[model samples]
Target: MVTPRLRHPVRRIGDRDIDFSRRLAVMAIVNRTPDSFYDRGATFALEAAVASGRAAFEAGADVVDVGGVKFAPGPPVPVAEEIDRVVPVVRALAPFGPVSVDTFQPEVARAAIDAGAAVINDTTGVHDPRIADVVADSDATLVVAHSLAAPRTQLPLPHYDDVVAEVRDFLEHRVAVAREHGVPAERIIVDPGHDLNKNTRHSLELTRRLGEFADIGLPMLVALSNKDFIGEALGRDRDQRLHGSLAAAVFCATQGARMVRVHNVRETVDALRMVEAILGWREPAYLLHNMRSEGNE
Candidate 1:
């Protein structure tokens, strides 16, 4: 099913206002950690992270999500280190576009917001509640993602009676909590946490049924960027899953997912634009190529 078109899904994040109804936005992944499952610390250094952020924005990222630690099982990083890892990068990237700090720690989130982050893309779905408080105190946006366990912990066997329904319920509850804590409804986004604690089958189900999440009424953000679920389904590795990831991304967008958090900014941006153009939400950049000109044709 095609996404029911929205009239005005415009919302501001940090310094920019995005019209989510008309244009699909890509949130580029800029990992500051040395052990992120996908990037493997390629941008862990401060200079590298800043450069990557710039490049992603240049490549058409509507936002940059900077994370100090990977979500998969890993050694615990101290709060100070987390702050150090993300703040500089956030500051460096603030002038480029909206910056989102991918952290659940209230302290680190606060630091990033102070340093010019417009959004806190917490994966815990406000598990601590204080993280919601941090976002409530700021004029920034909050991304509530559903996850079953603490960050970096080995995800236990997932047991959802109805994965899509359960994820929608969890995100609804978290969005309500965020509103109660003073974060405006317009500034909140929801994610179903694909592959966070789910196996391949569950993730696939969620992707197929993603349209159900529109009931949440907030903009939907899907992290389908070379995730394990895609790789598992295609018998591919992380490096070989770009094609699968793009396919999933287009599926999600068609189902009303307004935002995609991805590693390949340029490719995802192009795919989303093409999808939007086909949907009549956006126009092609040029019409001359297909036109039968009087002299050229």
Candidate 2:
């Protein structure tokens, strides 16, 4: 007979202790580019992009990550051009809720922070020194995502002696860098960068073993929404991976992800609530009904 594992109690973020036990936070992706792999041409217009951000917030997203460049296998945009593309959107969306700027360039990071973005979602993990200075000078939280190689180079074939250990090490190194730059330890979040430089197997292993990164002691953000690995796993295309994306979100929440960046917010939120119910991490309706019956008695 197999014993059921006990669910770990959800904890607060940073020393600030922000309670996240109510539900898994949803981060909606608002791509402000014409070349994004999944949502290309979907958010090209500024009005459409802002509307998408507003709609995502209405759909129960806790945060919105706005990006200017595609970052898919393509030519890189210049720093000035990237900033020009994202700052306006960030300025427009800052009043809604927590806004995150998705860029690795320091100039863009600084401009976005000035434009009222509360978080810096750096895909390159502060590879550029100026990015460190930008975060150090501001109150913005930094999300250091792990990408093995540049997207232009075909993802380096997912070579890893141990995927979990290498990813943990990379994140730990990034944390140390942020600390050295006067960015408080609690303000840092780590992401495994699913599908960024990883193949299907690497992404799967990372998803299954996400619990390992909890030892790093910072909030974990998982972006497995409609990624190609899900398509590969389900033998479906990007648009058809909705169910798979929700499944991955539930798995991430079970494995201790604090925030899930997804394109489909409502479905992911519902799936995570169900997972929480099954793990006894959340109060079950039947239990509540029984309590009401006993009260009547």
Candidate 3:
């Protein structure tokens, strides 16, 4: 269901263009929040955060997604504090590849863009118009994620009659708003926002019906890395969800998701590459690994 405008071999994020026709991009998560759900503040320090970015890039991540605050209703971090947390890391990682700052604040987005971030990963679906304006005024790409509540807030009860249909509708509207505000289609990405205000069932349904997102006609970014749904589905804990995460990621890629934001960089890169090779999107790194020829022996 992807339209002609959205079916492209390459997409221009900021100063870089990535080929998505035959491969899926890996967006590594570099969280600077002490209360982040996964790492639990392991990379909160500035030096550690920078080092994590470097490590992820070295591990084959196509993009680095830097976040200052955890998305789990924590103490309010001043805008200045948030800027201090992510800007330096973004600056350090920008030279390596495209860096996406995960924030919904317009001021923060502007600061991150100034700090050399190439994308704004707004998990709030650009609830604030100023954020859209900021993206429109800049050369950065915008990731429009569909979430029902504000970032870091616990929802009362999440319910959706048809999760995929509703999510698509939300993304369609947000994409339209971004376009109307002057952000080109080439600069826009869509995410269904797995586990962001949704319960386990909602997340699973979204994952199973991910192909439906192609109707939005934009590059899709899926963040299904060790999320709660994966945990619940397989009765695995956070650290134990890597396999589930990889499975969901592979499914998304097979379903036309262009980018997958994840925590395990090496494993994710390997899995996506395998999928690409299977689909004939990419040739094996080398075809002579275990081949036998009459002259060989």
TM-score per candidate, chains pooled:
0.96, 0.87, 0.95
Give me the runs in candidate 1 sitting further than 4 Å from their true place: 4-8, 295-297
Model 3 regions more than 4 Å off: 1-9, 289-292
The digit string of per-residue lDDT tens for model 2 on 122-229 reads 887777757878888987888899986653445656688998899889888977887788887657778988987788998999998888776666778899999999
**Alpha-carbon lDDT of model 1:** 0.89
Candidate 3 Cα deviation (angstroms), residue 193: 0.5
TM-score for predicted model 1 compared with the true structure: 0.96
lDDT of candidate 2 at residue 91, scale 0 to 100: 86
Cα-lDDT of candidate 2? 0.79
Give per-model CA RMSD. 1.5, 4.3, 1.8
RMSD of 1: 1.5
